[model samples]
Target: MKVVVGIPSFNNAETISHVAKVAAKGIMEFFDGDGMIVNSDGGSSDGTRERFMETDTFGVPKESFVYEGIPGKGSAMKAIMEFSLEQGAQTVVFLDSDLRSVKPWWVERLAGPILRGEADYVTPFYLRHRFDGTITNNVCFPMTSALYGKKVRQPIGGDFGVGKKLLEIYLEKPEETWKTDVARFGIDIWMTTTAINESGRILQAALGTKIHDVKDPGKHLKGMFLQVVGTLFELMVTYQNRWMSVWNIEDVPIYGETPEEEIPPMTIDVDNLKKLAKETLVVPEYVNESAVREVKEDGTLSLNSWVDLLYRSAVQYRKTRDKTVVENLLPFYFARTARFAEEVKSLSDEEAERYVYEQLGVFLERKRLLKEEWEVEDKG
Candidate 1:
């Protein structure tokens, strides 16, 4: 079967060469060099394209394309998809350019399931620092798990593999439906969610330790946060019927070994996040100001507080059909993360996972409230 490895890059001059070389090695070693490395760039000005092309491919075919139309990882991925389709590739695997710890095993392990017809899609199951991927730890993972009843740990993890059938189905989606966030940071979650909804065979491949350019949610740009969370909300609305009927949560089949190396825990900059939230917060007139005061004064927020916030906000967004309503929930999101980070700073991964799992129960418990809010959605 023809295999294609896709790397979506932007300003990745620091790490692109290493990632590309390892990926090429995986393809050459495992697939007998029958595959090609397609580097799809988002017009990186840091000479990322040059560095990627300069990387030794060990006789494997390599091509690089820079998108002049729109600048986003999703755009690059779309180009890669088109390229793979034209090449008649049966399996396509993607990895982010910033992955410093990705090994050759990652490529074959992620794509193997697809190539062998064992699975239609594969997601990376990375051994990351407990504090890394805060959004996934707190929101995306739990929300996706609760909704779909599948504990596919990283629904939005950037690295994954998909087959031609899945690729064709994705390409058939209306451009307007995904041209926004899905065209950017929302791409991973969008694909994962759609895959789950379609009942495709999805597998999680172990990727050892995923050490990459970790972004501190608090100090990082809000564009991605908004886009990811916004896309998540949109998907929830679109798949409400399916998730609403989900009665139990289950685990997906995992196909790799956990890393044995002792990974040091990542730290959270709570003080900086506190400062950022205070500086950037623009409270909507509809939020409960008193609850905001309580969170600000002591960094203490309850489960009900989050449920109420989500419930009311989801209602408002559904009613108004305005993105501002969904975006307005970001402040509370920031506050909640800040507080939770402090709580889990000293905790182990097992401890942290327990905390998040319990918290997800609260979300399920209060989902009826969201249903109630939906019933009386204010169109005013």
Candidate 2:
């Protein structure tokens, strides 16, 4: 097979069929039926696999099976990659099963660059609501850009296109790596960072607006937050040498035009979010006491303090490898997110996006602080 489109799913019966159909259409129409669609399920009882199997691929080959190993998206992806490798596929495009707005052209957009030998890895860039992807907008995007010297707008965006070489390297990761958060929600950032650090040719595919099952950071993201942020901090320590030597940010090449459309409005309970932030009263020793006091008094975390807290926690994690170092940052994350929601509540989507980048500038400006703290801890 020349191309393989893999969908990693759980209980997505409500939406997998649509994703499968478009994936098949994209593969057949763009790749000339030389592609296959595979669904690596997590044993969903919701008939997600059945729905996927039932979809007609217009003569394109398809298969659905429960993947083996710990039940997580990473394991599902590994199964797909292993299968793709066995089949001698050159390009693999992985799509989330719960996506609602994926188009047939998305397959071409993601896999086309790789097929043409222009890029080795593809990351999706979408026009999303101001409140959508709080973790990406607040943490992953900024940190990845600053540390890695490349401005990849969505480091943890779920959809991606992987070339064969990167796929092999990903599968070649040590056995224990998959057992950690990388097996769960941490997978996306792990793949993106690996591509950057490995010196692969990376580019962003402008997939327009990504309408997926959106989650509010305040209402439903504690587990995901911990896993992804923990993985990110761990990666920082692992790639300390690479990031320390990198200084300027370079723009990544884009594959398509930016789309203009109205983003769906997301609802967030700001008062309840502030309540959750307040509940995180036991601050970690590494976090500055004055920052805690300021959040307590103002019910918001400033960008400067947020950066300070993150660097301190990263230094502490490097020294101790204590997982709670990530846990302790949760409340402050909540506070920072709450502040972000309130600040962007009334702004237009364009303005909100600019604000997000402006926040990114803060992280970039304070890169020196993280390096200094990390070096101090290493010497001690």
Candidate 3:
């Protein structure tokens, strides 16, 4: 096949059909009915696979099946990668099943760069609500830009396009790799970081506004937070040689025209978030004592203190590789997120977007400090 579009799904029955239909239309309309759609399901009891198989595809070939290995987006993606490679596909596009804002052009937007041989990997760039992706806004985007020197706005945006070469690299990863956080929410970041360090070319696809099933950070994202952040810290240790020398950030090429959409307001329970942060914060031994004390007194971690905690914790993680290091950082993350919620609550989406970039600038400025700490550990 020339192209294979993969949708990794689990219990997404309500939205899978629509996503699959749109994907099929994109494939047929753009690829002249030359592409295939594969639904890699995680054995959903909610009949998600059945719903996907039932979607009308405008003559595009589609199949849905339960994937093997542990039940996670990563495992399902592994299965999809295997299938896409088996079909001799040249370009592979993966879309999350829960997307409500996906359009037919999304398929082309994601896969076009790879098919045109212009890039090896394509990450999505979307205009999301300020509060929608707190993790991305506060941590992943900035940290990725600072450490890896690529301004990939959405490293874990979940929807992406990969060429055959990149797919082969993913499949080549050892089996033990999947048994960790990569088997869960860590998959997106793992793929992105791998591309960043290993691939020759990477870029972004401007997909306009992404209106997915948004989760409030205070309530719905704890487990996901642990997994994604843990995986990121692990990658930082693993790729120290790659990022330690990256002193300047470079812009990644963007593929499509970015569209403007009126973002819908997302409600966040700030008081509850504050409560959670205050209640859960138990400053680990590795963190700066004074910063923890300030956080306790102020009821929130200021950006500078949060950076100190992260930098110190990352160095400690390098020393011990303990999961607890990442676990202990969670409360601080909650505190930082709560602070962010209050900071951006009154700003327009565009203004809030600029605020996020400004935060990225802080991370960029502090890169020297992180490098100094990491170098000290190396010499010690």
Candidate 4:
């Protein structure tokens, strides 16, 4: 196979060289040094471009390292995909620039299924640290399964391998369809979902170890939620008739059969966590005011608000699978709570907690009921 590895990077100068080296080693093992490394950068102000230009670090040929002019992760991937096709690459694997534990074997493991023709797409399964985002496990995976009838455990996993045919399909599609905010976080989900919808077999390979540095979940909560949920909602609306047919087919597999292994918990800085929480919880006064007014006026929110809620929910969904949009809306939720608190100034602390939780519960219940009805109609 004419394999090519594409690393989509942004300000990852410190880690990019190491990833390049490791990937180089892997490609060298399988192919006779024919493998190439394509770095699709989002105009890194950091020395990421310079680092890649320094040929001593990665033993691969210098001609293989190409920089793209685009700005988003999706754009970066698109650039690499186009370059790979022009280079006559038959198979391509994408690796994130920030991986910490990427071994040479990781590449082979990810691409194994595709080479075997057992699957068209390969996603990574890893032993994640406590603080890692679980949105893939909870929301992205299950929802994908329920909607598309394919059970890919880590639909949004950062690392993936795909064949040339799939790459061509992705490229031929309208750029606007795959190159938006959802594309930023939803690329993997979108890819896996599309592959499944097209009857392309999907597989998950064990990485044996976590690969990337963990970031503050709170900092990413809103963005992740918006990206994931926005992609899903868009899929729901745009492909309503298709997903409606597959909604209750129930062939998607659930994870948890893999044996659990002991791994050290990655420590999260308390100060950082607190800071992230405070920032995330502060709910921009404008977002709250506008969202509330919009909801009250139309009894429905705009696509943007729904996008924001999805992003926030993705963060919470990672922490707890049961989390829904209503559960993740706590930050914006205070707007209504403040009004209720003002109306009943004498309520005790316990009473206030109960009242807010109850209100949230009621809102979520109503949403669930409506969603259930929608699903029923869809399935019908």
Candidate 5:
């Protein structure tokens, strides 16, 4: 099959060269002379453009590289899809720009199932560091599995492989299938979800090693949570009828049972939890303005307003749980505001940092307990 590897890059100058060379090598090894590598960049300020222009030691010709206009990851992927179709590529494999542990066989593994017609979409599974988006596994994976009735282990995994037919379907229904959060973290989740819902065949492949840089667990939790879970929830609600059909399929698998593998251990910092809680408290302001509207004569928040905010947040975050989790967690909605208010009221400017840290310890411990309960339910 004619295979084209697309790398969606931003300001990835520091690591682009290595990623390109390794990916190029993988393509050449797997598909022989029929494989090509393309990088669709999002107008990087760094010398990424110039770097791609430079010579590559990987025997693949430099003419195979093309840089497109500024757009989100989805746009970049769209560009690559157009290019791959134009070039008559039968399959497309996408690798992230930030991959640090890519092996020579990575591309082969991702595309193997698709090339053989065993799966329509393939995602990577790897050993990640403790702080690497573990919340994705805890929250996103189960929600996707339960809702869609497919065992897509890495629903938000950046690397993926897709057949030409699937790519055409994706392009045909861009608004419905394409992800809007292309620049940040939402693109991957969008693709995975779309594949599961549209393509009956989807599978996860073991990458056998961790890839990409280690991220600060707490630093990105809120943003990651908001983008991934938020988008998922919206999709779930919007496509409720479709998902209900998927859920009712008795033969469908609800969980991935491919042997328990060891993943990197993550530690939740108390300070980070408090910071996230405080940050989440800001949702009401945005919600009140965007998702929630004041009704009646008074300007006070109405019940519909509260429900709208909750729905919007849950939709945007893709928080998947039974109705019970939603009801139980609804109470914590006000607690978020109260925590922020308490932080502001009790702590002086000089003491605020320390106070938050102290409060975070208690908050995270509570989170741990809640998580334990969720885990019990998940396993049971």
Candidate 6:
């Protein structure tokens, strides 16, 4: 089967060359058939395109293009999709251009299942610092498992592989009101949710460890959290019928290497988040000052409180379609996260992951409230 490794990039010049060359080696080493590496750029002012083009591709048909779609990661991916179709590529593996710890073996692990016809989609499984992906640990993984009834740990993890059928499905999706959902950070979760709700043979590849751009959760999370969560709520509407009946999570087979050593202990500055929480507690339309203080002081919220703050905000975003309302949810998120950090500060990483599942049960118990709020009563 023809294979292509696609890297979506923007202002990633510093690391794109290394990622490109390693990915090139990955394709050349793993795929016995025809293969190439394609860099789909989003008009990076940093000259990422030039750097990628200048990199060696071992005589492979590598090409770089400025994407013409929504001008974000998803559009860059769309460019690769178009190219894959044009070249009659049967399989495509996508890697983030900003990845610093990407290894050649990752390509073999991600693409192997697809090439063998064992799966239509492959998601990455990696060793990440406990605090590294707080969003996933707090929201995506648990929420996805409870709602979709399937366990895929890193739904928005950047690297993955897909076959022609799944590629065609993603290409056929129309992004109108929720363009941002399909545009930037929303793209990853959108892709994973699509694979789950729609029919696909999915696999997870254990790609050792991930070491890339790390950002502080309280500061760097607002924009990404808004986009990813907003897109998640939008998809909830689209796939309501499918997940409504999914109560049991189906297991998917995993391939490649799993981490051997214990990842080091990771921690976050809860005091900083607490201070931030105090500032934003009463800021806007959604947050209640009293409630914020109540949740913050105790470093935890009751199940009712959690549902009221998060699920209600999700419902509001879905109904009003106001980006501001989503932004307003930031303070509450800050407060809740601070509380979560305080509660989990003493636990080991494995214990912490399990503790998060208890939080998921609370979400599952309250999901009906969300369904009630999400549905509109029709008048005759």
Q: Write the per-residue lDDT of candidate 5 for residues 1-380, one digit (tens) a residue.
A: 47788887788888878877887788788778577778888878887756765738367753333444335676788788888888888888898888877766788777877888787888876555433444443445545655666656577878888898888887787464443443346667777887877787776777865657655444544455455655566566556656655432122322122333454443345344444433433333324453222211222232234334443445323344333333332223323322333334444433543333233223222333333433444466
Candidate 5 off by > 4 Å: 55-57, 62-70, 174-179, 182-184, 246-268, 278-380
Worst 10 residues of 2 by lDDT: 261-270
Cα lDDT of model 4 by residue, 189-282, tens digit: 7777777766456677777556576654434455665566566655655555566565343433222233354544543343443333333353
**Candidate 3: segments with Cα more than 4 A from true spot:** none
Q: List the RMSD of every prediction in angstroms.
A: 2.1, 1.0, 1.1, 10.0, 11.4, 2.7
TM-score of each: 0.93, 0.98, 0.98, 0.69, 0.68, 0.90
Instruction: Report the C-alpha lDDT of model 6 over 1-380, residue by residue, as the tens digit.
Output: 47899999999999999998888788778775368889999999999999999998777778998988676788888789889988898888999998988888888888888888988889998787767787787678877887888778888998989889898888887656336657878888898999987755888999867778787777788778888888887777678787777667666678965867556455677777767766665545554455666755753444457556777777676667777776776666666677677776777767877776666677677777766766652111
CA deviation > 4 Å runs, candidate 1: 285-290, 378-380
Tens-place lDDT digits, model 3, residues 140-168? 89889999999999999999999999999
> Clashing residue pairs in candidate 2, if any?
none
Q: What TM-score, to 2 decimals, does candidate 5 have?
A: 0.68
Question: Model 6 TM-score?
Answer: 0.90
| Candidate 3 overall lDDT versus native | 0.88
Assess the local accuracy of residue 170 in candidate 5 as a C-alpha lDDT between 0 and 100: 71
lDDT of each: 0.81, 0.89, 0.88, 0.60, 0.59, 0.78
